[model samples]
Every structure is written in structure tokens, then in C-alpha cells.
Target: MAGFLELIDNTLGTHFHTPVYDPQTGRKKILRVIELASKQHNEGTTRAPNRSWAAGNNEGISFSPKIDGKPVLIGGKETNFVHKSRFQDFLKGLKAAVEKGDLDKEIKAALDGDAAPRASTSSSSGTRSGRNPLSNVRSSIGRSLGNGKSLEEAEATARANPKFDAAHIDQVVAEAKANAK
Candidate 1:
């Protein structure tokens, strides 16, 4: 069982870039599994980070467990497989199961628990709401700087233009340099 858990952990770790087991207990951690699932959910779609591995869908991953001589499909809400808040409890339960050699029962219980909360759609909504307010300022400044203008031209313009403040620029530069280290 420990070997099986280690195999799963290594397989998952390669794909997810995160640890997937409780080292002390030699068990697969449920929270880590949930995190991997979440990453799979968000990787690859129109999502900015584009990490959805199984298409653009957010449907929770499925697991099959043999409990009491019956094979059960653990998915949807009963799995609570994607809920972030329940991660710690899930990990604890899984560790306990591994220690007792009843992984099958623990897996079944997780799969049969209350449905996890639906994944949020805020990323899509935020992207569509409009460009960030700061973006407008950046664009305006970029335009004012003009295409292919030399640094000398910019400096000359700043010196000749009343609106350009060299003192403010120096202060900003100084502050940024101070904070860089």
C-alpha cells in the first residue's frame, strides 16, 4: 500500500509540481490531491494562466474505490474532491486510513461526503468587466511618449514642458532603487 501511494505521489508530483503525500504517514494527502485537481481544472482554457488539463470544464475528477466488496464511483458533490476549505480534514482522514490499512473505506467516505462548492467563475467575469483602470493611464503615457522617440527627445521635452516634473521622477527613481534590494 505504501508503495502504491508512493507511485501515485511521484506520478502526480511530476505533473502537478507539488507534493502529494504525508511523508510521516506514507499516505496520499487528500488536500494535495484536491490542489492537483484544481490546477487541472484551471490549466488550459481561456483562463489567463491557462492550466486546465482536462479541457475547459471544472467537473471534479473521479476516483473508484472498493468498499465492503462493492466498487463505488466517487465524484460530484459526494466526493467533495475539489473543495479547498475541507483539504486539511481530508488529508487527516486519509492519513488515518493509510495507518489503519483501510484506505478503501476512507476513500469511499470522501467520495460519499457532501458535495464540494462549485468552482468560481470570477476569472471570466473579471476579464470581461473591462480593462483595468491603471491600464488606461499606462496606455496614455505610452502614447504620449510616441513611437521610436529617442531618450534625448524625451528628456528635452521634459525639461521644456512645465507639466513634466524632474524632481518627482528623481524621487520615484530613488525610492525604487532603495526598495530594489
Candidate 2:
């Protein structure tokens, strides 16, 4: 059920709308809100942006059933209007649809073909392994100061790296001076 929900989320975003076209008139018509579980609509946790399923409110896990820009009838009443206790039933229905391969093939293909977003970095190899670049530079500056290389040479080494800004260089220099004692 979780896997099916994840696949659906990756294909069609949590907050997205689809445009309904008039087949007889052959023109684009109403914009229908498909799946809406917005954070702004529900009160959230202090740490999290929205109410999680495990936290009692199923707003995060609930997915609405819409047809012709309106809620579909599940048990004589609109599915969205139903009480929150029936959220498990809604998830089961969604899982069944996924198992029957009711999702659009084109959307699945597009999602599968796209690459994941890359992390931003100055180094050619992008690895943020919890090491501060400034600290490394500072250590190198301290080493240089210990090796009898003048303060100017240590500053030059710090300046050569594009990652080290003016403030970073100053911090490194101050650390190097402190380490000399």
C-alpha cells in the first residue's frame, strides 16, 4: 500500500490539477483538482509541516476521490465528506486501482525517465560527508604555520581555494595564530 501510494505521489504530485476537455465540443474546459492533501488546510506538528497519519489525523495519508470536478459517492455520500475513520478504506481502494494498473502509462514513463535532482557544491565531486570545508582549511593553515611557512603563505593558500571566502580566510588565520602558541 505504501509503495503504491509513493508511486502515485511521484507520478502525479500531492497537489496537482487536471484539465477536463469537452469531447463533444472538442475544447479544453474545467480544471479539476485531483489529489489534495495540503498542509495549509490542516493543523501540523511543531517539527513537521503537516499532520501525519500516525499522529491521529489522517489528512497526510487521505486521498480524495473526484469525478467531473466533484467528489464521487462511496456509500451514498461523497467520499471526501465521509468521516476520517474510513481513511483505511480509501487507501485500500487506491491500492486496488494501482494493482489493476489503472494509472496512465505516459505519466509513469515520464517519471521513470527523469533523473533525480542534483545537490549543489563547489567541488567537482559532490559529497557532503559532514566535514566543514572551513575547518579543513583552518587545519591546513595551522599545519603551514607549524612548518615555518610565513603567515602570508598560509593566507595565499587559503585564498587560492575558491571555497574559502574573505571571512573564512580570516577565521583560518586566527585559528593558525592561536595554534602557534
Cα RMSD to native, each candidate?
A: 20.5, 20.9
* Candidate with best lDDT: 2
lDDT of 1 by residue, 1-181 (tens): 5677555545545658644434333224443443444444445322323221122134433222232322332332232243434434544564455556555444544444312232433443212125542333333334445554544443444445443345643443344345547
Show the lowest summed lDDT stretch of 10 residues, model 1.
47-56
Question: Each candidate's TM vs. the true structure?
Answer: 0.19, 0.28
Cα lDDT for residue 100, model 2? 52
lDDT of 2 by residue, 1-181 (tens): 5677655545555446755423322111101122123231244322332222232253333333333333333333322342455544555564445345443332232233221222433454322334566666777677677678899898997688666667878887877678769
At residue 106, give the lDDT of candidate 2: 20
